[model samples]
Target: MQFYLDGYRPGDPEYRPAAPGRDESSKGAAALPDEVDVLIVGTGPAGVVLAAQLAEFPGITTRVVERRGGPLEIGQADGVACRTVEMFNAFGLAEKLVREGYWVNEATFWGPDGTRNGSTAGITRTGRVQDVADGLSEYPHVIVNQARMQEYLLEKMRTSPSRLVPEYGVEATGVEVLDDGGDYPVKVTLQREGGDTAVVRAKYVVGCDGARSAVRKSLGIELRGDARNHAWGVMDVLAVTDFPDIRLKSVVQSPAGGNLLIIPREGGYLVRFYVDLGDLDPADRDARKRFTFDSIVAAAQKALHPYTLEVKSTAWWSVYEVGQRIADRFDDVLDAERGTRTPRVFIAGDACHTHSAKAGQGMNVSMQDGFNLGWKLAAVLEGRSPESLLDTYAEERRVIAQELIDFDLRFSTMMAAHPTDPAHPELGGVDPAEKQRMFTEAGRYTAGFATEYTPGLLTRSAEHQAVATGFPVGQRFYSAPVIRLADAKPLGLGHVAQADGRWRIYAFAGAGDPTSPDSGIAQLAAFLGESEDSPVRRFTPDGADLDAVFDVRAVLQQDHRELEVEALPAFLRPVKGPFGLKDYEKVFTPDLKGGRDIFDERGIDRERGAIVVVRPDQYVAAVLPLDAHAELADFFAAFMQPAAALV
Candidate 1:
């Protein structure tokens, strides 16, 4: 799974163009068609994820445009957080990316004098901090460059049923949102690199085109935040170094040579150095123009002095002025009074928010932005949900963007100041202890785990919060190991909630009551098997494939051998494949590794079964009593098109 880029180094005779079809003109190439359902700008992490998700809907047509001629092979953001890996796992790409990248298990820290600082340099380990998300996910922080990550996603999109192919060497030069109600409400002007121009219409458009987003500018959106006073140099290099923590993720603060952030990349020999370039006037054009490979590598050498460091080869390098900014709104228009607004033109990722890439979140958060928006957009486009559901995308993600900016603002300043600078009296310059505490605390948010959304049409009241105390409303559902009752194979509950874009209902059947017909689990199963009028049936539109829009799985607290698959109600175990010869996935048991129970891990009572509703993106939407059929039916009716209405 490890990937190697050959014959394409900078200035090489065989070097490929940054983008393909860069020399092709409209006269030679086919012009863009008049319309597409979803037109996405930029093929970065956000754009590719958006394209891939939109391809899932058969009725929707998705197209992505990138200015680059081809996918990048290296450089930029690295570090896939635990939650992001869970998302990739849900979509069937986590294992592939994990295999191709290095899993960062611990972080190391160094002080001004090149001495390790930690409680175990007798007090703490300088280069080995505790893993922040140790129990949060099965996956660890992975170090795959953004270029490679996008390539993986792009390949997935290419092989998908929709066969989505992004348009390269094409850029969005203009966007016009049509006020007149029509099938295609957005007009986008695309220009190829060779001066060929064409216009394509779309029901919706999204900008994932980095900080210099033409889409955002065309839509008149403004980014609100200030640029930092410091500049930084980042380089991906293959090097021979005597530094002991070269392989570990290390944060080194120097009193004179500037701070250095070391990130070990996929290959064991390659490392990324993020060197603080000290204070420089943002308005000084000449100073900014002086950065080069030699200057950047010199910075890295100075930061790690006394330890001989020699760069054998460099893959990529860039000088960046650190800053934080977020769009005032994710969408172009907002009309709350109408209860419906055209989410026609949108911005995400760097187009919506920009921060220093040192946190390894630029690409991760960007991909997640698409992750959060894709399902909502798909639901609306397919008439599965109302337009109002679309508004929640901006509402939920904007807050996260602002929070990220705030964190980076503080982090940039802390890292920019020298370890011995007198200006920062609070800690007498960069205090390694304080920095470690803050960095760990920030990981909770940066790792994308503890983010809780507000209650909207998707989330229900907090009254039932006690039912699944560990799985809260409007939060991504936590995972725990569970054994399949039919086979006794252990697996995490999240594996069943894969990112297939389906609403999931988990019926935790607490210690089965075969003797009582009216008991909680029995009553629920009876309702499901009764008829098409069952609450479960109401969730799906008439004539629609039941599994296409939603999934229902039972988690029973019963021993694998003791439980008979035939004894389970029809609803708990649906039949599928070749004239119903095969059973759908069987109910899972709470018992897991080390005899631990998932019910206990999630704070669910083994005697009191509960019904948990999970959104398409796997956020826990609601938790109700097992017998709350009426309430459950009403819940689906809120967003889903009723069977009667569909007919």
Candidate 2:
């Protein structure tokens, strides 16, 4: 929340000054640009996230198009994962979402009770487990409408420096990658609402369009996977139920009746149900047509057994056959054997991978796909990083998408299976306890904390991992609480990271006093600030803020009150902004009052200290010794271009 850097005038500091030609009056009426640095297809979670992130970089021209006439109002995906919530914090949208969405704390499992003496068996609460494991994330798993989430992201783009607004009533018809090495190598054919069509050229194109993506089709990529014949009907309804765990996230399984997954929605009165519609016949051409909203409600009531459900209103409902599919490749690199071919067009979200919704991973992972690709695209477009950096998007995200598909297959199978059916002993039944255990163990992945990228251009080798064991290389940097040295404000170290496309270097002070010249922090700061070949000096443009390309911060072992801000190194408190005011938020200390010692919690060695390099998307790139300056320089040189080269 740093502000007033440009010598603020008065009104909302958060309000970004509009770009040169983008005024409020020209919002939707403005014609589509014939050329753009990046062109995005679809306005789903993935597309909106990419647009929101690119909007931060006003220097690059980014445009988004959707086939719909306007914003999404209802019916798509819900369930925002903990990791997605952390990402939203970077855009300053986490608090509002948490306040508006329903927080899922515990999940209860219900199974048929054999002890009941009634003609119809009753369901009994078998097990209750926490939705997210302890300390998995500071944020909670939330359930909100997908439309509301897009609206928030859209608002962020509207307020950003780029003043980005999606062009509705327009759809991408064709895509072609030109062989000529020109500025805009990708040509896109767009069809407007009427019969009119136009052509636009872009340096890069991202397909966030759903399962049936036209962009993916243009690339000649095929989704290869198996469809399990299981059918499920999902609906968001306003209902009154006698079920005890109606408000809580609950799973009900009946031997004869179908299974139901009940998730309470945001408004407290609304709840979403995924009702098992049984297996569909292979010969049936339109299985979904046979099931209506009333049939789905009846199936849900049957699954609840003794409990009853009276649906007053149906908000949204759809029937879907369980299918886990993923594209063969996520990029336009058709012939990978041809070495060193840079990808010009990419696909993300449902365009890349899709699975059942019961796992609540479709929207969560889709947003992450955009987050992973957005910063890389921005860096290359701004000439800050080489074009080769774009190659890592497909390599990394494709693996993650595959993993999600695998997990969904296992989870969906268990949910669809009957619980210990004696008559059909050949069909192995899913035990209630075993189901609960699977859910508990899969918390980390579902919460979005378990994704780890392999060593590549971005992720460095874990040679110095022992120095900082908690912040593993190639994984999202786990946040910890720390007190700001300047104002003594308590906050998470990761919260300081915004989606502004800048690298983060956290220098932990060694055993010696940080103010002493002999300490590692002081030496490292001097090297980064004075050395000619240091990453900060080589990549940062001339006359720009010293922390513009790389934000260097220090965390000392001593309390904030005991340390003097003036004694810290120049790099720790660089002067910036039009007024040249000294920035004081770079230095931090452990929160003693909160009993959070980051050094102990994250296993940072206090005697030797360590340096953590985090990517713009908040993933830890490398962990090195305090004096590993050469390795640090080489890491950035692998992708980042020198400022002089850009000039």
Model 1 residue-pair collision total: 12
lDDT by residue (1-647, candidate 1, tens digit) is 10112222445342223223322221222235688788889988888888778756645677788898877676578878887888887767888888989878778887654343332221123445855556666777888888888887777666554556777899999999887839998999999989989989988899999889999999888898887767899998999998888898888875547888888989788999998877777678667568888988888887776566799998888898888999988887755533546477889999999998877677878888999899988888777777777777887889888878887788777777666434456765757767777778777766777567777778888688777787888888888888877678788888766655788888887655632565677677777656555655665666554455667778877666667766667666664433443344647876645587888888886677788988877788899978778888778778776533343
After superposition of all CA atoms, the RMSD between model 1 and the true structure is 7.3
User: lDDT score of model 1?
Assistant: 0.76
Best by TM-score: 2
RMSD of each: 7.3, 1.5
Positional deviation of residue 461's Cα in model 2 after best superposition, in angstroms: 1.5
Deviation (Å) of 163 in candidate 2: 0.8
For each candidate, give its TM-score against the true structure: 0.90, 0.98
lDDT of each: 0.76, 0.90
Off by over 4 Å in 2: 26-30, 422-427, 644-647
Following a full C-alpha superposition, what root-mean-square deviation does model 2 have from the true structure?
A: 1.5
